[model samples]
Target chain A: MKKKKMIISSQTMELDVVRKVEALSGTSVRRCFQCGKCSAGCPMATFMEHPPNRIVRLLQLGQWQRILAGRSIWYCASCETCSTRCPNKVHLASIMDALRKLSWDAEGPSKESYVQLANRLFLENIRSYGRQYEMRLAAVFNVKSGQFLKDLMLGPKLISKGKLKMFHQKNRNMAEIEKIFSRIEEMRKKGEAL
Target chain B: MDKTLNYAYYPGCSLHASAGEYDLSTRELFNLLGVGLTEVPDWFCCGATPAHNVDELLSLSLCAKNLELAEQVDGDVAVACAACFSRLKFTQHTLLEDETKRRQVEKAIDAPARLDGKVKHLLEILARDIGLERLASAVSKPLSGVKVACYYGCLLTRPPDVPNLDCVEAPTIMERVVEAAGAETVPWSHRMECCGANFTLSRPGVVIQLSNAILDSAKSSGADCVVVACPLCHGNLDMRQKEIEGVYNAEYGLPVFYITQLLAVACGAGAEKSGLGALMVDPFPLLKVKNIL
Candidate 1:
């Protein structure tokens, strides 16, 4: 197995991430005691760079830079195990979500491969048509990720197996989908306006 | 006639496709049971796993559209697909539980869809609305001693609020439903384990391992067969059974059935009427052993 080398930078604070964290957390972030219970309970944290408890502490300590760059935010399964079990009821998932938005805004360390591809295909499909079409998303993701040549043989086999559908059912009102996206885009700009 | 509740039923992509049996059987059963499911007037995708993995707001907001439509009808929505039910349920759960974040999601989606009323899966409604006694009385054919392993995959039970129908670690709705159908529910591990859902495509090896664990666990528990409420779970366990067997160099020929299929049997509906044979793995032989046929 090959190990990939990377660099670590000194952490700093950014007000936007802090404000975002405070905005999402109903109770004060100060209530947390760094028990590591939340991270211990997270089912998906095994795949995370930093688990829920650490992310919360980062906010408590005002290490906003590291919080924004950690890839753990993207990998959370949103399972709510941590939130439901939290003693302080700090809503760790909600905090992670806000940090995720900050991470996307910062465009930090390379997004995990499958997570990035899946996100693009999913949003593009939703933006284009009102609903998801799995086959279409798989094709788009495969092509964009440059895996077309490797799985070239499996494509035809999948089609023959009836695993991949030939076409997708578009929503009856596509204009409505576009309008919804526009409204969301407008709101995103407004949120960023401040 | 109380027509108070209205919803946009986002049957996940598989509901109408390979899992059409689930799509059809659920529609029939729900109507018979008096739950009004007006297919969303205009619906979009739930973004499955990708949306949430890619962008939390994107997935939650996309799900909010379906919930928003339910709000337009001024009623709560119900989803049949396990993955769809879990995703939409999580969105509603997230919003209602956190006021500030909920506001952000509402803002992110640019729609103020009220997340009222429980987003129920078919099994929960049956177990709750159509009580076990009523279900038992309606059973024209008692499942008797048929051993069924009730498999609740990660989505339906985990993330607490998503299903919140029963214990996440040990869900009993499928067990209760199977009991109502006159079948014995077999207790086993891997009941809450992930079946690698959509990962069956991207990572078949992982899926094979997960599927094998489930099948082997059920077999060890003395289950003659397995029953599931989620079509995606059924597809993974049933369609991939052979692959799992091949990969493990073991024969685990357990038959998997949709809970509704077994209910149709208990209701005295013939297999033809219920489209039981349409499953990727035929369950007739198991039915024969139980004398259900």
Candidate 2:
């Protein structure tokens, strides 16, 4: 007798990641009857390849690969209309968020988008400083992403218009901020490895 | 007991820049109200529309860092800007819902703090905590008969729990505040409509269309002016009114104000002192016409 190997398709898995999403959001995912109301109410649903309702369905199946690989999850506006209107109160916005975390682990679509890259650098900068310094974030984002002069023209105009403040007003007890984020990051990595 | 409440405040990029008036007036008003809002020592962009448009988790982590810090404090974190409020609240909602995702966010953020639902907007604190009765008593000069259109915009109330200050759809915080200041808030359709927000840079035409809808709704409803709690709304409705007018071939210079500034004005804090002078489109004339000045 040959030994049997277990395989998981787009359908089967122990992927309770959806459960994690629902638990974290405090919304009842079990009650989602696939009414499509969440998708219908989202303002940015048209721009998404997978609408909020469908995304929730995908999460239920533990189709993590498709979700992490898909770009539609990134397009959610966090408008909360879907969650607001959901009869079952499935927080579609949060599930999309969970998928984004999966994407980070899989190193999926985040590579191509400079905006996403900028966001990482931006958060790291904030993690260090505890507040955002726009001028610095832009400069750092441009240098790292190799778009050194993307919005070069707007610098002087923004400064003159008093729109861009020069320096960050660093928060006191910044180490506390660093510590908090560090804890969350550690927890996230451990969860992903599981 | 003088429990000095403290929290990390994100002025959002716009509040520091285009809507400096909001930054100024909010801080001033908070100071007057005895709430200490220290800028989140060194915060990053909330990733508002940009990151959310590109990567979902990045946006969540971006907001989580701030939300995490807002939770670090005892009192609910107060955001002067509605965009920041919405993003922070949404991130809080997202993080608390999914345990694995929450762990992932915790990993991604890797900060030394923990969060527990303390994020909120200024309007919320004022209405729920401070109470409109107190806000009314603070009013020195009555803004009687000043017909105003209270614009809540999309970010403030849509998610319902994203630091919602009032009812999700037909929010009445602005109205209550206005009425507290002795002003009349007219009902209008485009109250919660998007003012193209940052999309104005990429999709000006869409914003122009939507802004026109908002302005037309207010104007048609006989509003003396539009009062908004968000800086972006003020930008589109007030500063960019000319662009909207050019597209539609009509005149619309409806005064848009930071709700706090209006509160200050109604409370007898002079317009200039309230940073009302900073508004790109002068609302003084409208105030004069409405006899509120």
Candidate 3:
């Protein structure tokens, strides 16, 4: 791993973005005294370039660009282990969500697109059908991610076990669901929500 | 006893589709136990991990709307999926604590956030509401000599305060419920570990690796099979068991059973009623070997 020299100065530090993260996550990055408990208990730490503690450290340093550009936030499974075990009461999992949301809102300079794609398809499924259509979600994910043959063998077995339904029934309250989506969009547009 | 417990059931989206067996067995088990379960009419997704992952407001609003819909039914909500259970509980917890988030969610859903309704997972319904003694009395066919690993996965209990199903690090609810049905619970590691969750879809290699550790722990602990409360856990553990075994060059033919399926079967529900046939890795071999079939 190449260690890049970090130049921390008034011009380089973006505390404004750090404050946005703090407000969004409802957790203070300054509260973390580098206890390393979050990283110690994090299950996805090995898969991430910046572990949970370092993500918080990076946030404290106002290096939001480095954090977002990496795949650490994308790889979080949101298991809440870090939040559960944190001695300082820092909600690392929620912080991960806040970071992901900000990155997602910016259309993400994130190196990890597969996770973003999966999240998009999942939300789209909710909007279109008002529920998840597993068969369609899997099929479309494979097609879009260009992993055409991924999990191909499991498909037949799943269908045979009747686990994968051939068709889906949209929820009866589709109009109500759509209204909620539009109202949230409207709220975001009006600066009423983050 | 206890004024006849009834709940507004929220099976979540997975239960209706890939986790259909969980839905079947929950209804069957509740029926056998003389509990009443009414589905929350027209309830949509609670915006599981993905919704919360990228859009917290949308997640909260979706769950808040579902909570409102659950209000139409006669009793507290009963959630089967662990992910849905966590999201619903987190929404209630957040709405009660954060005024701004609550106001935003209320406006997004076009209704006042309903935070008063209790969202209880099926495990809670069994372990706490129904009582372990009552659960034990209901089990006609005690699963003697069958060692089981009670896999909590991630959502049932975590983050100290949220979910509040049991002690976050050392939960015994699943074990207590299974023990009530006469199965011996094995002590094992990785019970509360994450199974890479939704990454099962986006990055299955992650699921394969993480779930493999869980299965290995269960196998080494002398657990004949693994039992779980969440459908996603079942998917990663059971559906991907063979693939994981192949990848690791191992031979853990452990059949993962849903907590409901195990209890329902012990309470004398037939195989079809318990949806045992739907399991990817066959459970009958172990069930029959233990004379549980």
The per-candidate TM-score of the B chain, in the order shown, comes to 0.91, 0.92, 0.98
Q: Candidate 1 at residue A67, lDDT?
A: 58
Against the reference, the lDDT scores of all candidates come to 0.70, 0.69, 0.92
Chain A TM-score, structure 1: 0.78
Stretches of candidate 2 off by over 4 Å are A1-31, A54-71, A108-118, A136-161, A172-194, B1-18, B30-77, B86-120, B158-164, B195-216, B235-251
Please tell me which predicted candidate would have the highest lDDT against the true structure.
3
Off by over 4 Å in 3: A1-12, B1-3
Query: Residue B78: error of model 1 in Å?
Result: 2.3
> Could you give candidate 2's per-residue lDDT for residues B16-113 as a string of tens digits?
66678888887776666666777764465676755554345556776777666555446667787887778777677766665555666656766532
Clashing pairs in model 1, backbone N/Cα/C closer than 3 A: A79-B159, A131-B45, B8-B40
Residue A82 C-alpha lDDT in model 2: 75
Residues B105-173 of candidate 3: C-alpha lDDT, one tens digit per residue: 989888898898899999999989989998999998999989999999888898778899999999999
Decide which is better by TM-score, 1 or 2: 1
Q: CA shift at B140, candidate 3, in angstroms?
A: 1.0
Ranking by TM-score: 3, 1, 2
Grade the docking of candidate 3: high
* Model 1 RMSD vs true structure: 4.9
Report the poorest 10 consecutive residues by lDDT, candidate 1 chain B.
B1-10
- Candidate order by DockQ, decreasing, is 3, 1, 2
How well is each residue in A61-120 modelled by candidate 1, as lDDT tens digits? 667677565666766655566766787767776666656655655565545556555666
